[model samples]
Target: MSDIATVVDLLTDALGADAVDVDPASLASASHDTWPVSTKWARQDEHPYPADVVARARTEQDVVAVLRVADETGIPVTPRALGSSVTGQPLPTRGGIVLDVSGLVGPHSIDEIDMTVTAPAGTNGGELEDALNAAGWTMRFSPQSLYRSSVGGWLATLATGQFSSRYGGVEDLVVGYRVVLADGEIAELTASPRAAMGPDLRRLFLGSEGTLGVITQVTYKILPLPADQRLQAFRVPDVPAGLAIMREQAAAGLRPFLLRFYDTDEARHAMADPGFDGPVLFVGTEGEPAVAAAEMGVLTEIAARHGATTLGPEPAAAWMGRRFDFSTVEKRLDTPGGFAETIEVAHTWRHIHGLYTDVKAALAPLADEVLVHFSHVYPQGTSMYLILLGQVADDAAATARLEEIWATAMRVCLDHGAELSHHHGGGLARSPYSRRSLGSAHRVLRRLKHALDPDALLNPGKLGL
Candidate 1:
């Protein structure tokens, strides 16, 4: 039998025949992710890099069984959850086995005493959040894909949510992980109350992109649902002034669950404010009633000091109602000869302005229009999202244009001394630049990959591995 067949037989014996699928339809579906280039390829009736088999793992033991067979047979195995990653993080580049872990869900356990919630990696993020909400608790992580993404994807990609300014990213929320290594050995990296135990080993898998191991379970810190909440929008003179207001608020140790600043173009398009004439800032706070009020008051003062005009709560409220609506990009992607992409980069306050200007300028020629915003902020820096929409004449042009857009944006970010990606981990889209972006640290990553997955079979071709 061929290598693919041999691995398929082994996996079938280990996890049962029902768990393995070799149907052409399943294989085709497993080949690509939500990568924009893949959409173009699909339009041309192409299914490149189709996996030979898809193995659905219903439990941790099933994951171990799949990895064990792949390890013994040297078959490339890509772990996948909801496949919501737009950067092709879960694509089986080498056409081996697509290990489906979406079934390893729930039987979630929440420890109200410790303020943490543990769930199988495949648990849907929105479901988990809803459960927490019903219990008067929350993880405070709400990515745009909350309804579609899995917990594993969140940790795998180091994803951040709209509320990241206050609650922080997935890396900050995760307290532990249950992972299955490439060699089929299970490792539990959980410690409570912040231990100093040797470099925080759980981080090894937080953004590993499933190269080092498969995350089967996760434990995230939780918070009681806030008793009070407030949201307000302000019209700022320009991007710089808006950013200054955000920086000052963060520097003053105020944590707002919602903190976003949109450039004039993006504000006019994204917000419901029809009369938007300048850059806009959205601020939201949640906590005890008095505390939330105090924070909102400070934000208003800061905005006034920066020459911002209050637009009341309507704009902010409207945003909150549809914060997860991604139809703008989705609609474009659904149309023929059209595409939309969002690139996010970050830098300290000093370089952010220049970085934003340089990247936006470089990308303007590539896309029909470039809409910019600063959605996540920190005391020292903030993350900028560049949303661009464009149309091409054909599939070939769409493919080429997508590549050019990514290349131009990444080049400008690196040139301007900015992080290549703020929260979107290095997937296939960023793999080409991962080495240069990581620099000396790339060597360290290679060593770790070799040490854990010497054959380079786990999610091969990602993270420049």
Candidate 2:
């Protein structure tokens, strides 16, 4: 029998008829990720509905059953949590099955003594944080996707948040996890304040891109809500001057709750061209009111030396309003012939200016127009987020343009010696350049995939697995 027929039979018997989405229509939406560029691939990339089945997985046993079918049929499968991914990470490539775990959400549970929360991967970060904050606690991490993005996807992509300069990231805050491996084995990261025991097994799947495993649950350390908070804004003459202001703040060790920089193009679009006219810097400070005031002075002082103009409280509130929900740009992409997207890359303090210069140099020629914005500050460095706007006549030309821009952007990041991805996974679009950043380690990663899932039955097209 063909793999499709064989796998369908197994899924029906294993999961019962209720869990499968046999309709060709329902499965189509599950097959593609959110890339305007992928509209180009829509014709050739018609992913076959796996053995013609989509599994609604809930319990651990259900996941294991799905994996058994994956290994038996040599078809691929990818797990889904909260369904908030922009990059097609949750979409099943080669169509073995989309093991949807959104139904397995756990009840909000918090431990006041230990200051930790244990919950299923299906849980939403914003929802969990709301509950915690009501009880006089807080989750410092706030990725731009916070409103809709889940804790699991954020951790899977090594996501950084708006307050990354203070709270660190999902990896540093998470102390434990329940991960289901590709071969159906379940591994739990032991709960501990800290461990000297071997390498952190928790980190193994932290940013593994759903290729290594599917995370089922997470337990994280929590911090107390601050007594005071403040957000401030500054405008710089140009890119170099804006970056210099950031470096000066970092050098002085004034780590604000939020430290973000936006280029002129991004600033103009965001501020409705007020004509005050310059790149913008935003810093959020929170803690004791006295301490918040001190940090604000430090930030304002640094900007003055660099010729940056000050915008008072009103602009800061405006920036905070649209800090997340970047997916609005996708609305433009949805306009039949319109296309828009963003790319984020990271590097250390020394290479920051050079990386920014090269990335624009590479992508500008390919795109009709390119805009860069900075958010999610950290002691190590910043994340450069790129936005592209293009209008294409047909699928063929759109594909060519996307390919060119993605390639040029990847080259610029690598040539300047920055990590290919700061938060987002390589997805199918980013996988080709994985070799550039990962090198020989990429080969070993493939080997690990073979050992754990020799059938290549898990998220097949992503990260080149």
Candidate 3:
């Protein structure tokens, strides 16, 4: 039998006939993800890189079986969960086998005493959070795709939540995880609160985007539901003014769960208040009630010093209610000639404003509407999100325009000495510029890839591997 046929039979035998699917619909769906270009391709009835077979794994052993077959046959295997990656992180580029792990979700456990929750990698992020909340706890990692994304997908992409300012990113919350290597070797990495080991190995696969191995299970640090949460909005004079307030708040070592600042255009668009002028800043704090109140007081004083006008809690409360809503992007992408995408980059406070201004200006000609926001703030730097919505002549034109939009944004970001991606890990969309973004450090990734996945059989063509 040919390689494709042989692999199909092997996977079917290993994972059972019912678990292996080669239908046209399955192949087409496995070929792409929520990437805007893929949406355009779907609109044009194109299955550009459909995998020959898709193997749905219901257990960790199923994942190992798929990897073992790929290792023996030298067929590329792309591990996927939920397929919610907007950057094509889970696309089956080499067309060998798409390892579906969305069904592996099961046997969840929460350790309230240790403040940790462990679950299968395929667990839905929102479902996990809801379960934790029921137990009087929370993960606090609320990405925009919370309801649509998977736990493994979040760790694979190094995702950050809207409340990243206080809880940190996925990297911070990961306590331990079990992964199956490209060679079918299962390895579990864990550590205490801190370790002085040779290297923090868990981080190796956290942002590897499934290019190195398949994450089968994960343990994340959880927090008790906050005692109090205070959210308030402020209107600032401009982007710079709002940024200054955010900077001061961070520099003061005040940890507020929310510190989102939207530029004038984005503030108006997001709030749906065209009449409202200038930029808007949403500040939220939680923890002990007394501590939360004190932090809010400090934040308010800093904003007032920066010439900000308090807009009460309504706007902030409204945002929290629908923070996970992605209807706007969905509506645009589903439209015949419409395309929408988001690019998030980060830099220190010094160059952040310039990066924002330059990237928006660079993307202006290609996109109809470019909205900007600074959401994930830190003491030294912050993340800038560039939301692009535009319409082209047709689906074909839309695909090309979206590509151009990404290229332009990455170019300007690189020019400003900023990281190409803040939390949305580099997938096919950002693979081409991985070298430029990583500079000489690119070689380190190549070396690691060779060491772990010498055959290059796992999620090839991503992270410039």
Candidate 4:
């Protein structure tokens, strides 16, 4: 019998025939993620990422058993859920096993008193949010992929939602989680609002990208639904002026649930209102009516100081209504010889403009369109999202051009002293620059990876680990 068949037999014996899948279709589907390079390659009939088998784990015990067997057999296991990763984090680069936890759906419990929600890894983001909303509470974590992404996937990628400026990123929302280690041992990390613990172990796994273990369950902090919400839009002269307004508002302690600064091109595309031109800033404030009103007043003053033209709430409202729609990207990718991708990086106010200008200039020649926006604002800095779309003669040219864009963008970011990835965890696409991005800190990650996964069986070839 073949080695893979032998492994399948062992897995079937350990779990059950129903849980182990070796079908060609399943393997092919598990091969890649939403990464544009991977998608382009896939269109060319090149499946560089294919797992030998799949383990549809439905419980924590199933995860443990699969990990134990994979360890014993020295097989790489890539934990996946929802398959919404844009960085190929779930793609099994080495032929081994794809551990799918999408079926591990369990009852989610919300604690009104504690202001927290505990959910299984497979819990859908939208469902969880709806449940919280029905209970007069809000998850406050609204990623663009909320309807499609799983909780575990969010934690795995250390994602930041659209309203991160107010609620913070996934790391801030996640109070704790239960993870299964490489040796099939289950470990739970939990803490109160403030823990004087020696080291925050929860952080180690936050952005590990599943290179260390499998996150099985998560506990996230929630808040009462905002009593009032106010949306406002403004047109600024350019990115720098818009950024200054954002910085001033943030520094003055105005906490808006949503603060988005879109460049001219992105503004035109996002607003879809020809009357609104130039850089557009969409700001939303939500809370007690008094507090929301006060924040908006200060925000408007700041925008005016920066020479912004008030565009009313229509543009902001429009963006909010269609924020989750990814049809444009899907349509672009489906076009013949066309490809598109978004690279998000972060930097302090001091170097953000330089990073933006350099990266845009670097990528302009390689892409048909280069658009940018600033969101997830903070007092210290903000995250920039660079969108690139291009067409090539063939798959080979497309792949090459895509790689060039990534390489140039990363190089410019590094040169400008910006974070390589703001929210998306370093998967295969970003793995090459992981070490450079982390500098000496990369050694610390390596040590942790070695300590946790001695054999590197958990999601191999990711995060530069």
Candidate 5:
């Protein structure tokens, strides 16, 4: 029998027949992510990295069993949820087993006293937010993929939401989580608001992209829903002026719930009204009425200092109404030989503009249209997102162009001293550059990978592990 057939037989014997799926359709579906290159390759009817079999895990015990079986049989295991990852995080690169954990949902609880919520990792992000909102509370984690992303996926990728400027990323909100190690050992890491515990074990798993272990459950910080919310829009002279405003606001300790700066190209594409010509800045503040009003006042004053033209709240409100609409991307990709992708990178205030300019210049020649935006701002730095769209002669040409775009963009980011990724984890798309991007720190990551998963049986070929 073939190796994959033998592994499937072993898995079926260990788990139930219902848990093991070897259908060709299932394997093909389990293979790729939303990665543009992967999608383009799919257009050619090819699944280069197909999973051998899919194990539908319904509980933490099932996850343990799957991991144990994989370890015993030397099969690489890739944990998956919702399949919404655009970075190829869930792709089974080595054609082993795809551990589908979406079935392990429910049995969640909220602690109003402690202001926290706990749920299985497979729990849907949007459902959790709805539950919190019903109780007049909020997780404040609203990524574009919230409706499709799972808690475990968020933890695995260290995701950041639209309101991350105030609530911070998944790393900041995740108080604790339970993980199943490669050897099938289940471990829970928990802590209070602040801990003197050595090393912050949670950090090791956050953004690990399933290289170390499988996240089974997560506990996140929660807050009372904001009593007041405000929105405003402004048009700055150029990208640099918008960056200056964001830097000043962050440095001044203004914690706006949302701060979006779209370059001229992105503004033209994103704004409902395309009359305004310059870069557009959207500012949102939410909290107690008095506090929100005061914060809006300061934000407006800062915009005025940057020579911004007030465009009222209509544009910002419009953006909020359709923030999750990815129809444009879908429509673009549906066109023959058409492709689109987004690359996000981060740099300190001192080098952000240079990084932005260099990357934009480098990608402009490769793509038909290149749009830029700055979001997830921090006191010391911010992330820049570049959206590239183009059309080629066929799938092969599209795939090659997609690769060139990624290579060029990553090269520009590294040369300019910026991180290759901000919120999106380094999945297969960025794995090749992970070592170079992390520099000397890559050695430490390798050591951790060796210590945790010496056999490299978990989510291989990701995060340079």
Candidate 6:
């Protein structure tokens, strides 16, 4: 009577026992995503929908084989990478199958002439960079999640990182890819230097969240490793001065790779151990040593103008060391009553001050402790990554706080006419607002998924599928 039984039979026929998971834990693991912080506080224990079977896909052939059966059987299939998505994007709510591609990371190439690199989807940013370093090259995309965030996961979820101000988002680094559609058909988007060829079909897969197809290979534009690198520290009096300093640097055309402005609260907590004076700024620049040194000087002058003081680079560097960790959140939640929440929002220079004010105000009364920080920025606007944690005595209370805070923050973003999300993909959590920002574009995405994956079997329950 269960659709899962039928879907399992179909998967067994296509992928064989080696690729399919029949174990209870494996299936359950595929059911939910890293959304417990949000779901738990809301009293949601039923989420993390476990799949009937999880296909540990190793190659494109395995992916195609599994998708073929899923399509024919009308089974819901969820594509999973590193399982690093914070939202419920990878959950198989319908519980059919999960295509785990973490093992599919393969070779990468460096075209010295074109300055591009082609790597398999399962490749991780850190691993890819290490490989490039061995070959005397570099993969420039560095998110805070580089340790666990796979290149495929990066593309699948449209992730971003600390270096985004210079390298831009994952979409900016991604140029071409090889995708396996829901129909089991594989299409390899070429790594052409440029393309006027049609609608550039590649863009569809850039941030589709696995609804359109399963990404198997990722080809990106690589750059030579910058020769010089340095991170300077500064303590600003307030948020306004920090923002003004960043804007001035951008205007002066001195773009620093590690340009971050943290809210006083987060800075205080981050540097709370000992010997920390106050709010500090970590300004890192990379390039020729002389040029980098000059840029640091420029940043120092700007910070001085903004009434900022130096906090020494040692503590700032230590903070950067532990910058990447989403798994620790669940551990904290498992204890009595702890919560972790983050919101990424971007707006034009004209709107950031007011936008930040409204967002903080919205969450003021609801949060136990709200700390804001600036991780990624652009010339046009900056991303405000807000982290709110509370002690609610149980998971349900924490979940309610997270959901309520998210609702309030989303409303703030909309009120200012800002983009719905800044990287981290639209994931399931942000899907409701997709229509508001994406408009008909969301419809087009669903149509594309339907056309490519007519059975609606791929990545079910993600991006509103």
Best-fitting candidate, scored by TM-score: 3
In the predicted model 1, the residue pairs found to clash are: none
| TM-score for each candidate, following the candidate numbering | 0.98, 0.92, 0.99, 0.98, 0.98, 0.92
Q: List the residue pairs that clash in candidate 4.
A: none
* Model 3 clashing-pair count: 0
lDDT of 5 by residue, 52-123 (tens): 899999889999999988888888999998988888889999889999999879878899999999999999
lDDT of 4: 0.89
User: What does candidate 2's lDDT look like per residue over 1-465, in tens digits?
Assistant: 246777778887888888777687667666655655554455445553332467877666788888877877677787776655655677665666787776667686788889888887777888888888888898787877776777777777777777877777788788788878777888888647888788766777766677878877788888788999888788788988887787778778887887778887778776657464668887888899999999988889889999987887667778778777565566656655566767888887778888888788777776667888776566667778888888777556666777777888887787788887777777767877787688888898888778766766677777766
Cα lDDT listed for each candidate = 0.89, 0.75, 0.90, 0.89, 0.90, 0.76
- CA lDDT, candidate 2, residue 384: 84
Q: Write the per-residue lDDT of candidate 6 for residues 344-405, one digit (tens) a residue.
A: 77887788989888898888887676778776777777777777766776666677677787
Clashing pairs in 5: none
Which residue pairs in model 2 clash with each other?
Answer: 50-95, 76-457
What TM-score does structure 5 among the candidates reach?
A: 0.98
The runs of at least 3 residues in candidate 1 whose Cα sits more than 4 Å from the true structure, single-residue gaps closed, are 273-275
For residues 384-455, what per-residue lDDT tens digits would candidate 3 score against the true structure? 998999998888888999989988888888888899989888999999999988999999999999999999
Candidate 4 lDDT over 1-465, as tens digits, reads 237777798889888999999888788888978888888877877888889999998889999999888888888899999988888899898879999999879799988889999999988899989988998999899999999999988988999999988889998899889999999999999898768778988887888888999999999999998999999999899989999998998899888999999999788787886565599999999999999999998899999999997889987898899989988777777777888998999999998998888888888999889999999899999999988888888778888888888888888888888999998778988999899889999999899999999988899888787
Could you give the candidate ranking by lDDT, starting with the highest? Answer: 3, 5, 1, 4, 6, 2
Q: Name the 10 consecutive residues with the lowest summed lDDT in model 2.
A: 43-52
- Model 1 is weakest, by summed lDDT over 10 consecutive residues, at 268-277
Clashes of each: 0, 2, 0, 0, 0, 13
Q: What are the RMSDs of all candidates, in order?
A: 1.3, 2.5, 1.0, 1.4, 1.3, 2.6
